[model samples]
Target: MASSSISNAEANTNQPRETKFEKLTKRGRENQAKEVTKMEKTRWTSDAEQQNYSVKLVEALSQRSHGNSSPAAEVSHVAVRETADRLLAVAAKGRTRWSRSIVMSRLRLKLNPNKHKKQKKPKVAGDMRSKKPVAVAKKIPAVERKVRLLGRLVPGCRKLSFPNLLGEATDYIAALEMQVRAMTVLSGLLTGTESLAPQFDPLGSGRS
Candidate 1:
């Protein structure tokens, strides 16, 4: 019984001890899904953390652009894209909403020097076309058509039939007559064509 127990103890010592944390190994294909799940929970919860991540992302991209290239070699677009994606993935911290395309778009926007620069508003074709007399003449027919339509729609406008419209016309005529009388008097004074009215005497005679 003692000899059998010694052999069993040796067998147990040789056997690998299974532990709970051993399931979390990076190389284990079985733990990949679990690892991904755990990583998905990680995120930059604060502005400072996010800012730091952004700085690292920028540095990584810069290195990929400038430092990784050999003197004779041009950096490939695919390589640049891959580098940007890797950095962005790290910055993303397994955020589900940040897909690969979104991350790349954001990365490009952030890195581009001219992203925030305001683009000049494009000039319209009409703006470039000069407002010549010919163009003005061409537009007159349209304006006349609109005015004729308005005249047809407006009451008494077609034949000046409304009393209110007639009154308005008379008022306008009266105003023009008053302006003509004032101008005639002024011209008469200037040309010495007429004597000053008694009311126009400025030596206190007009008041008396």
Candidate 2:
């Protein structure tokens, strides 16, 4: 009977210690979770600071339209580069670190500091546009040259193959289009402009 009583007392004492430990661990987790992680905010500098989001986006979208068209035989990078740069500029103005596209970069990479290693870009023949333009033009295949330019157009896609680059370009273009549409609607609402809201036919009625 005495031994049983002592055993019961010991168990009661251990219970509180275990509970205290659990409470401490839970409290630590809660403290860690108190800080929320979000993308870096945009800070507008120089000319961008003066422009509103709608105007900035519209201007950026226009950059792609004004570029020189490429030969019919080859895919052109001019439009892609112009559009990506302008879209990136808008993202920068908002002080957002978009990395490459509108889709957010990985949370794992962001949480882990110094995860990205800077890679040295492979050196290529110097720009021949100013000097021996004809020779330089002949040396690099038209398709290859356009691919390189397309890679540069969309950031973080330097190594992607043509198909992948095309996919990424399409995604970037769609993202920018949506961004422009959203900004236009937002601007209209803010300025009390009776602009007609965009209409989409969710049904197949619009199709033949």
Model 1 backbone overlap count: 0
Best by TM-score: 2
Tens-place lDDT digits, model 2, residues 129-207: 4466676679998889999988887756778878878866665554455554555554555475645233321121231
User: Candidate 2 at 201: error in angstroms?
Assistant: 18
- Per-residue lDDT tens digits for candidate 1, residues 76-190, read 7676555544554454443322233345556776799578688888778768454567756677777565655544543225544345444434433433343334334434544
C-alpha local distance difference test of each model:
0.49, 0.52
> In model 1, which regions exceed 4 Å deviation?
1-50, 66-69, 72-74, 95-208
Distance from true location, Cα of 206 in model 2, Å: 27
- True-vs-predicted CA distance for residue 177, candidate 1, Å: 72
Estimate the overall C-alpha local distance difference test score of candidate 2.
0.52
Clashes of each: 0, 4
lDDT of 2 at 104: 40
